[model samples]
Target: MRFARVRLAGALAALAVLSAGMTQATAAPAGKPPPPGSEMRNVALDTKPVQSSTYEGGTADRAVDGNVDGNWAGNSVSHTAQEEQPYWQTDLGKSQTLTKVAAWNRTDCCAERLTDFWVLVSDSPITARTLAEAKAQKGVTATKVAGTAGRTAEVPLHRKARYVRVQLEGTGYLALAEVQAFNDEVIASPSPAARKWVKDNPFGMFLHYNMSTYQDEQWADPNASPALFDPTDVDADQWAAAIKDAGMTFGVLTAKHHDGFALWDTAHSDHDIAASPYKDGKGDVIREYVDAMHAKHLKVGLYFSIWDRHNGDSVELIQNQLRELLTKYGQIDYLWFDGWGWQVPYSQVPYQPVRDMIRKVSPRTVVANNDHLGTLRTSDVIVYEVPVQGMPPETNARPTDASDTLDTNRTWFNTTATGAPRSASDITDNLARARAGNSLFLLNVGPDRTGRIPQDSVDRLKEIGSAS
Candidate 1:
């Protein structure tokens, strides 16, 4: 179940709050509070995680390990035995202004075990050995989550506290895949380069064409056989033409998604196009896509999932894959990364080295990381996924981009019954919203199993083209 950080699985459920009297809101994958200070820092990484009791091998340290992967089977969860009231808390070494607390649930199974929970902040030390005594120490009742159905969840807590705790009131086993604490709110500002990026690419296309396309599901299992990735008439040219006709300046293709199915043949592993029947184990979708984009004088971008359920993860693999994509394919205009910080925190795949690698290979390429953490420290252009986080605020702190599926289907890929494209008005409306929010809109249109964008989607793009 350790999918290469398969965020496409939709594990996070966010609930946002502002101070005590502000109206509480329900959202998906909320961000840091909007205040100026140090960058959004995960204070938990510097502290030790403690819980009431450990269940089996579920140690409290697992929750602070920077992995938001909700699959307990992957050993990323912190577990506490069935008790009257169980709790997990971490110390900040000193009193700090806490912005928000995020707790991940066990998604592999028994997610209800973490049903009802509360995120409490206390200025006083939570030194009490019992839950009652601990609750007394909590200075502020940050928020109490009624029940969790395993969706994207987070809350903004502008409380100053030395200790933060996630506790359950009823008797039940407590399993947390991960727990994260961020301090200071996010203040927005666009990097000089990011501003230029936004200027050049205000609208683009997102092609979700991969193994998930063959499986007819939103997300394919990590162990899905590569043999299923058999596209009879895959045409990257058709994709480029569609985007060009749509009046889009750029396009990003899913070179590899969270399922770890790389589109290009690589030395990293065999879980890619090389393993499929396409081109007789020599197919290179990245090559075809890049060349096609260049043919139409359109910018080329590649969507790379940092988490991998198939080939596994490592900095070496990432660097090698980047080298191949950048060098072999010529200049990649932009690189859109997924599953970082949100799924597998940057702690695992440190940013500086990867950033240096990209700079070394392609200095002009821009980065759009979907970490869901709104800080320019990571993304060159902060990406707001429409389905996950409705819209980027008109006051977005940094250069921004927004993404949403054109298909009406729930998932990102084509399924048994192909999805109809969203209405042109709906598509254009979001585009306007994106621009108002200082973002470029990258609308996803997944290609069907035959390796072609559906006629309906192409027609929709034409309609959008006319509207533009």
Candidate 2:
């Protein structure tokens, strides 16, 4: 196979492929082809058994257990105490050329514990007992790979070796969901099908209708009486009709916001719609919303806030809520995660487990985190909330969406005082700008406390749709 050596300034030089066939192989009937230019094959699957420096509650074999849901954790304490570094290793049975190494971090909890690591490949047996000894070994090439919070670290190793080792750098703990080694093939970014769908449906509606809507607050107090969350005239069909009339292809409803008040009946939380007086404690807004969207043949999306003021920032609780949403709904198209900076930082949140659960339940659901950037490496789409300008510069490598409110003011939820709706020209201009930058434009409209969108916003959206 032909190869090219790529040397980054002041860093270790490694070989990379200049042509497409360097990692290309025949595809199985059921297997999809790798993205355009790269060929990737997972070589760590069902290979020789794996070994680790230390483990707790499980063997090192769990790291290569071929189960994305399972994980291997270090024996060190979960706190911030400094301790010896942890490591996991496996012999490939025979020396083989390697291209990339992907290590999945623990997603259920303690995701930030695994950070600043090294992927080492050696021809001889890896005899180093400690992390320092493993790094000091001669004739061994190593590539430093930094962990991305709760995402996989797919490090490229353009070298050859029979033994592969992953050693942690700092204190905390060493945990990994799975470790994979690829020979010559690299997975493509943002599948072509996904990209095309986003391009085709560039305009969607963001329905900010939740318990907070009744309180006229962006973030309602968690202790607010559940009886106050009463919508007199609930009409999911009207919301769907408004969006369809606006020429939007999809709609995202606030299923659960920062208040920890669920719009659907959740068995895990008593503070959900089922506990509220709406529909005599028997309402399921999510069900009506899903049915309405499906009847209109429009895609359905749900907004779930990661920060929970009432739930006390428990990782397992967040995961359980996500499981309920993903499984209860038949087929959700998008999942919008919001409220980042509250009690727990995004790094500490177990995003990978939630992401994995979403994939397991609804494989086609597009995941978007409100990182407030043009794009994020971990999320499928980057979201910009209330952009003053029409759209941000096209800097993100993935699809982007600019979400803003119809009202001129910053109010996300309903208010008694009505703000002037953006003129049809203004809405059209924003859409044009978003399309120019290859981004989706999500226009927000908050329904009143009585669960009905204002007439002015509906008329404005219809005007905007006709102008387009």
Winner by TM-score = 1
The Cα local distance difference test for each model comes to: 0.76, 0.68
Error of 2 at 273 (Å): 0.7
- Candidate 2 is scored at a TM of 0.60
* TM, every model: 0.64, 0.60
Model 1 segments more than 4 A misplaced: 1-189
The per-prediction tally of clashing pairs is 16, 3
Q: Give per-residue CA lDDT, model 2, range 173-228, as digits (tens).
A: 66666677876544335555456656877999988888787777777888888888
Clashes of 2: 3
lDDT of candidate model 1 versus the reference:
0.76
Residue 181's C-alpha lDDT in candidate 1? 83
